[model samples]
Target chain A: MKLYDRVRVINDGYEGYGIKKGDEGHILNAEIRYGTFCFYREDPETLADDASASVRIEDLELVEDGGATDEDILEELPRHNPEWGCKVIDGFIYNLKGERLNEYAYDYHHRRIK
Target chain B: MKNLEALYGKVTDYLKYGDGWVRRENISPKDIDVCNGEATDDSDTRTCALCVALNRTVFKNDNKPDYTHPYCKCEQIPTAPPEPTLDFPMRKITDYLFVKKRGLMYSMGYSEEDAKEVYQMIATNAKEQFKQGKYFLNALDNHGQKVNILLAFPGKREKEGHVYWIKTGWTVYPNGKLHQNTPFGGWAK
Candidate 1:
């Protein structure tokens, strides 16, 4: 599954992560890691959500494709919190309202910073 | 504290220089959630301490790595020392199995009274098995240092007679400490 693709958990082995079979979530990203296809979860929002697990591609089944765009989600953030804003003073750095983020934390396309 | 000293070496070595080792909060890019197909603050869960004057400091040698928060990004600078082989302590093992995941243990046919025996059975074998590289990689947090190793030990549940009870989550720190994040995920198919 690719990023933004909605998918269902086809595996019940993730009970420790509070994820069970039939639960659905959005695919934040996907890539080959440690020689296996894995995806990240972004839905089933909850306050207690703090950890992200490396889900194998086979464990998930696509529910929908190309559901939401970044701008669609960005437009919703300021409505929820007014302090939220992006200031790129330097090389693709996204700083928070109160934090001084100078070093590049991510790429322009959200590719993880190595 | 002694365990940390044993793992990291003497604190006075760094203290003599006066620029002692401080555990800086190491935030991995994986901890930051991506939104809108790009990195955004909308889903970031990290809470920055507003005061900004440096919250706390631990000696480089002391090596008091924070274990309280699962998502804690505390890191020791100038290259974290290597952890000795088999750093999974019994206290951490039992904490994950008994307290953090007690309910799941019950669901897997273990009782409150069986906590000690259950851990004794699992922990002893887990350490030995881990030494022999008998675990599977279930998942990994971003940056890849923090990983989830899947481990299974035999247990007899009430409904499911003999089973390979899977303990699917563990994390590796920059200092090379192995921590159990989740003990009971379910049984292997």
Candidate 2:
């Protein structure tokens, strides 16, 4: 499924065609102390130049739900991604990994944590 | 009178040589609204005279610090006495009080004299209201040594007439450090 369409589906709280093993996804994480989220793709080589790399999630989950079978290794995906880039969704951007993201451009760009 | 003398001595002792202390006096409800430099109304003049008398006693205390008694006529002004029985309504005013460090009073546009006059008027009113059993008084700190007094009148209908009172003052040590004292009083319903 297209990344945008897949994100739209999961965000709606419905389990559609699920993320497959070895299929690259993005991870999003939140920095609670700073009141900010981070985004980064799992593998840089898999990221398409034109495709978004990251998304932001409400929080990190230790295990992924909605796997087809119990044998499926529930990969804990970050709510944010960096390499695949970001897309604005629902006033927030969701990445291929189903994570939420934000643009890092800030007043003091140099001081931003990578 | 001996008690007054003894109280004066204690206050002066607290003042020390070049030291400063605050002098508080009880004021009547009628005197609360009077303005500065304006002739005090006849009814309240007696109250004002009491304040002046207290000021004189504070001045005569031998224990007071040198270089002009730390008792600047500044704090000699009368304040409303606390009411233990009557209930009065408290009203909040939009204007906030702000005091600057080093014994300076600051208001948006008012000169030093003007600010002092306004402050005196407000303090008087707050004290009177407290006596009438209306509101509460509070204080805010600024730049360490300076403090602003707030008169928070009661808001609840049942608490309508209680007033809170706060008076802020500062003493400067020889090392240039400032010590602050904010005495609080209340007129309970």
Candidate 3:
């Protein structure tokens, strides 16, 4: 089986729907993590169009030493807003609006890890 | 929902026999010829039969789920199937299959029109394989008859590559056949 050399992080604007840069809506101190169980074909078009595409969460680790204390966390608040919406599923960070984020989330949250 | 089922059935028939079956539904022959283009004698009957069986077995629900209309036929469905507890990694296999086939198609420099046609062909074939129960090896299922298949491919993202994942639901047959009712959009990527 072929494994991706490096996981691609498709950070587009989907998750941060109503939330803004400094808004509390951005999940910053919540130890947010995300990943996906992707079903992709070699071709870009197919990969893009796969309706069944999904992601899964393996683990959610605390953003330990996120470069600061509470004061530091607050200082870095703007940066914490996941320049894009970063969700944690099965211990991986993934963008929400990408091709497989929802599927991955469903699989992981629903415990369909394989 | 019944209308949606009828539409789904019609689309499946169209995939199985090209546009001819649709033409038989009182559609004009000229429209059929235009939509289907030139008919190739290389059609595989095995794929058609498998599609018919898979749709019947997997999507035969009488009651519609509380999600979007099943017959919408939009690129993205408003709702997804309920997540199952089974650990069948069928999504991985389906992904691998998609990547393998699409990668080959892309490498061959197929035009958009050709790619779309080929994509539909692959989906139909996969549905047939699933129906025949002869394609995949490892799978998991719940009591509801929902099955998942795990698949892998070997290759790099830029070059040849293989990866693993799972796929769920009855729309896809257990044998790894493509659904005859739907056109494959993967090739358009």
lDDT of 2 by residue, A78-97 (tens): 12223232333334443445
TM-score of chain A, predicted model 3, versus the true chain A, to 2 decimals: 0.18
- Report the lDDT of model 1 for residue B187: 43
Candidate 2 lDDT (Cα, 0 to 1): 0.27
Candidate 1: interface RMSD in Å?
14.5
* RMSD score of candidate 2 (Å): 27.3
Q: Of the candidates numbered 2 and 3, which has the greater lDDT value?
A: 3
| Model 3 error, position B105 (Å) | 2.2
Candidate 2, which segments miss by more than 4 Å at Cα? A1-114, B1-107, B137-149, B152-189
CA error at residue A54 for candidate 1, angstroms: 13
Q: Which candidate leads the pack in DockQ?
A: 3
lDDT of 1 by residue, A1-114 (tens): 343455677887777765677877544322223212223343343211123555555566777664333343233332233233332223332323333233343233333333
- Every candidate's DockQ is 0.04, 0.01, 0.11
| Model 2: lDDT of residue A52 | 19
When superposed on Cα atoms, how far off is each prediction in RMSD?
15.9, 27.3, 19.5
Count of backbone collisions in candidate 2 = 38
lDDT of 1 at B135: 49
The predicted structure with the larger TM-score, 1 or 2, is: 1
